[model samples]
Target: MTIKEKEEEVIEEFSFFEDWMAKYEYIIDLGKNLNGYPPEQKTPENIIKGCQSQVWLHAYMDGEKLIYKADSDALISKGLISLLVGVLSDQTPADILSNKLKFIEEIGLNEHLSPNRSNGLSSMIKTMKAYAIAFSK
Candidate 1:
């Protein structure tokens, strides 16, 4: 699916939970389901800055598409990256660069996250976009 479609699907999924507690549970579940990351890829270069917990993100191009792999020491941070990876992976660099990722706001993630987590989320997005920029060249 396209990034927008994947994002909309996430938004719809989040809408089912009536409370933040349930939503947080779902996020943790999503984190649990993330594919295993390679130990070798957990280098300092892969670590996202400005996060309270260590978040490692790696990306590679599969032909014209970018595939992302990520892991975090913290549960919520892991889940947050999982959401981004689920939506942005397997997409072209241009597509990743162009999309604004409005679903983050739509799902109330921005409002619900703590200040540190929120900044971490922004760093994740920035790092993802930076990868896109590099790969697009």
Candidate 2:
């Protein structure tokens, strides 16, 4: 699917929860499904700097698309990363750079997260985009 279509799917999935509590629970559940990151890859360079929790993100170009994989010491953070990876992975770098990922706002994720977690989320996005930028060449 296109990135926008993937984003819309996320918004739709999140819409199933009427309250933030249920939403958070669902997010945690999503976190459980992440493919574990390789322990050896948890180096300083892979670590996202701004997170209160240790969040590790990695991305690379596969043909014309970017493939992202990540992990976090924190459950919620992992879920948040999963949400982002779901939407943004397997897409072109130019496409990723041009989109705002407004679905984060659309899902009210920004309002529900703690300030530190919010910053971590932003850092993760930045890290993924930075990888895309490098490989886009």
Candidate 3:
């Protein structure tokens, strides 16, 4: 789906649930829908370092915008990465670099996550954002 449509869907789902349990479930479901990366695409070159879970991410410039493809071995981690991609994919590198992922906190997920999980997610996001910076340079 288009980012706008996905955003609308997220907002609508949030409107209905308004509770963290429901929101977390929705996020997990969203992750379940993440497209898988072919074995060839999940090469060492594409691997995102520092995540506790195995993550592979590839980013390329499409015209003036950056597009991303990513995956992870762990289920919820995959979903978390999908959530990050949903939040930042298709936008300009500059946009991705400028806007903080404030939604994680706003959604009340950050505080509930274990310290290690939070760090792993942070590392994944940092790698993605760093790629945007690299591509934009």
Candidate 4:
């Protein structure tokens, strides 16, 4: 599926939750289902700066698309990254760079998060876009 399609799917899925608590449970499930990053790739370079918890993100170009792998020590953070990767991965670098990731706001993810986690989410988005920018060049 395209990025927009994936994002819409996530938005629809989140819409089913009756409250933030249920939404959080859904997010935690996403984290648990994440295809974890390799131990070897958790280098300093892969570690995302500005996040309170350790988050390692790695990306490479696949033909014209970008493929991402990531892990976070925190469950919520892991789920957040997995959500992002699910929506943004396997897309062209230009597409990723141009995306604003409105799903976060659409699903009320940012509002429900703690300040630190909110910042970490932003950091993850920045890191992903930076990778896209670099790879697009």
Candidate 5:
């Protein structure tokens, strides 16, 4: 699916939850399902800055697409990255760069997250886009 389609899927999934608590639980579950990050790849260079929690993100180009692997010391942060990864992974760099990921606000994630977590989420997006920018060249 296209990035926009994937984002809409996320928005639809979040719409199933009747309350924010349920949505939060869903996010946690999504984190739990994330593919394991290789310990060796969790280097300082992979670490996302400006986050209260330690979030490590590694990206590599596969063919013309960028693939991302990420982990966070905090559960909520992990889930947030997992959400981003699900939407943005295995896509072309141009697509990743152009997409604004409006699903973040559409799903009410921005309002529900703590300020620190919100900043962390932005860092994750920035890191992912940076990877895309590098691969686009």
Candidate 6:
């Protein structure tokens, strides 16, 4: 399925969980399945700033869409990054630029996150947006 379709599916699945903890667990599990960067590509250049845990992200344009790979030292954070990337990857620059990831707030993760995590999340979003901007140019 397309990333957008998968994201909608996840949102639907999350809506089925009664407890917020269960939703968090589901997100973490999603992260566990993400394809991380190769050891060789794990460098400062690719590292995402503002995250409490070390996170690395890389993006490349494949035809009309942006492809992404990312990793984090912390398991839950890795999952968070994975979820973000999963939702945003494989999208064309214009689609990504116009799309708003309301799911973060819709699932109520934003209010529950620590200040640092929120900063990291913003940084991650900035990174993804920056990639789209650069590729579009």
Best by TM-score: 1
Comparing 4 and 5 on lDDT, the stronger one: 4
The lDDT values for all models are: 0.94, 0.89, 0.77, 0.91, 0.90, 0.83
**Global fold similarity of model 3 (TM-score):** 0.82
Q: Taking the tens digit of each residue's C-alpha lDDT, what string does model 1 give over 5-124?
A: 999899899989999899999999888888779899999999999999999999999999999999998888999999999999999999999999999999998998998999999999
Which of the numbered candidates is closest to the native, going by highest lDDT? 1
Residue by residue across 1-137, what tens digits does model 2's lDDT show? 98999999999988898998999998898788888677788888899999998888888778999988899878898999999999998999999999889899999989988898889889989998898888887
Question: For model 4, which pairs clash?
Answer: none
How many Å off is the CA of 124 in candidate 1? 0.1
Stretch of 10 with least lDDT, candidate 5: 27-36
lDDT of 6 by residue, 1-137 (tens): 65557678667877888986887788778767776577888999999999999989999999999988899888778888888887888888888888878777766678878889988988998998999999996
- Candidate 1: the clashing residue pairs are none
**Alpha-carbon TM-score of each model against the true structure:** 0.98, 0.95, 0.82, 0.96, 0.96, 0.90
Off by over 4 Å in 5: none
Error of 1 at 126 (Å): 0.1
Clashes of each: 0, 0, 0, 0, 0, 1
RMSD of 6: 1.8
**lDDT-best of 1 and 2:** 1
Native-to-model Cα distance after best TM-score fit, residue 30 in candidate 1, in Å: 0.9
Models, CA RMSD each: 0.7, 1.0, 2.9, 1.0, 0.9, 1.8
Q: What is candidate 1's TM-score against the reference?
A: 0.98
Worst 10 residues of 3 by lDDT: 1-10
Query: Native-vs-model 1 lDDT?
Result: 0.94
TM-score of 6: 0.90
lDDT of 3 by residue, 1-137 (tens): 54445555555556677666777777678667888566678888787777777888888889988888888877778888888888788888888887766666655567877888888888888998889889886
User: Candidate 2, 23: how far from true, in Å?
Assistant: 0.2
RMSD of 3: 2.9
